[model samples]
Target: MPDTSRTQLKQILATRYAYLVRRLERITGSKEGATDALHETWLRLDKANVSTQVANADAYILGMASNVAIDQHRHERRHAHDDDVDVLLGVPDELADPERILTARRKIDSLKDVLRGLTPRRRAILLAARVDGQLNREIAERFGISLRLVESELSAAMKYCLQRMQEAGDPYTDSRSSGPRKF
Candidate 1:
């Protein structure tokens, strides 16, 4: 790629970094998987042939990230580490020990408790904005509420959840803040 094109690509990448990561997470179903996919996409972008004037750098990166995610998924499926016997028996080759499972269950229960503690509308808004990837305007329209209300509820819900997570010793807590970050 030409120097100007590379610079442009870098700018696009910087601006769309969070959005791309969220998209990869939605596709791959895990933060680690998303990170791996992003790294692969970056590598591909660095080596991409751009001999012609490109249209829409954001779309190009999104397409590349999607392709990388698909390739990663295929590779994982083909080289699955689980033993053939395990697969035939419909069992995992290895499972977390009972203690780990119990701990995870406890953490999930704590998270649920925190969520249930929120007002119903706030909880719904949080789920819509975070889990369903709905914009504030979309959520406001869907709920027949004002955009400012949607934004306020979402912010409050996030802060409450982060506080709860911090109280529960969640590793996601940010050092600079009193609680976990807004995802």
Candidate 2:
């Protein structure tokens, strides 16, 4: 027998175009989407290998149209639209600009200068408590000083750094200023 399935499908599509469009519109929820699906179905028919005969040509064509619509939807979802690309491009970069980077370097240099200006004992106490992550009690025992003296030295060092930073026109906010250092 001839490829009657393909021929029958083409005839049905040509004859029942409007009816199929209405049915597909209901299935796809939009006239434009339904029209596009039917057009895609027509294009796919030329490439399809219909070796076996179809018992129900209308259902077969409708099923093919539905598959085409689903495939179209999947394809569209895989690629970003122009508006999506524009929105992505409009997002601000997280990296600091050159001027911000220079300002940050200057602030760091100012902090280094402030650290260098501290007395050796005070600097050592501050570095031990803050940078070296030593406990105040441990620092006091290591330096042969009382815990009260350790706290006093750490506090003075912090206040001196804060004053120097403020005078340099870039104040550093201390988050732990609410209470004494715990660790």
Best by lDDT: 2
Off by over 4 Å in 2: 1-93, 174-179
- Per-residue lDDT tens digits for candidate 1, residues 1-183, read 776876788777777888878877887788788778777877777788888766988777777877888898898788966687577788654667898799889888988899999999999999898789888888999999998888788879988998988988898666465543233
TM-score of 2: 0.45
Question: What tens-digit string does per-residue lDDT give for candidate 2 at 1-183?
Answer: 145667778888989999999999988989999999999998877777767788887788899999999998899888968998999999998777998899889888988999999999999999999899999999999999999999999999999998888787774555455676656
TM-score of each: 0.44, 0.45
**Between which residue pairs do clashes occur in model 1?**
none
- Residue 175 miss distance in model 2 (angstroms): 8.0
Q: Cα-based RMSD of the predictions, in order?
A: 9.0, 19.8
The parts of candidate 1 lying over 4 Å away from their true place are 1-95, 175-183
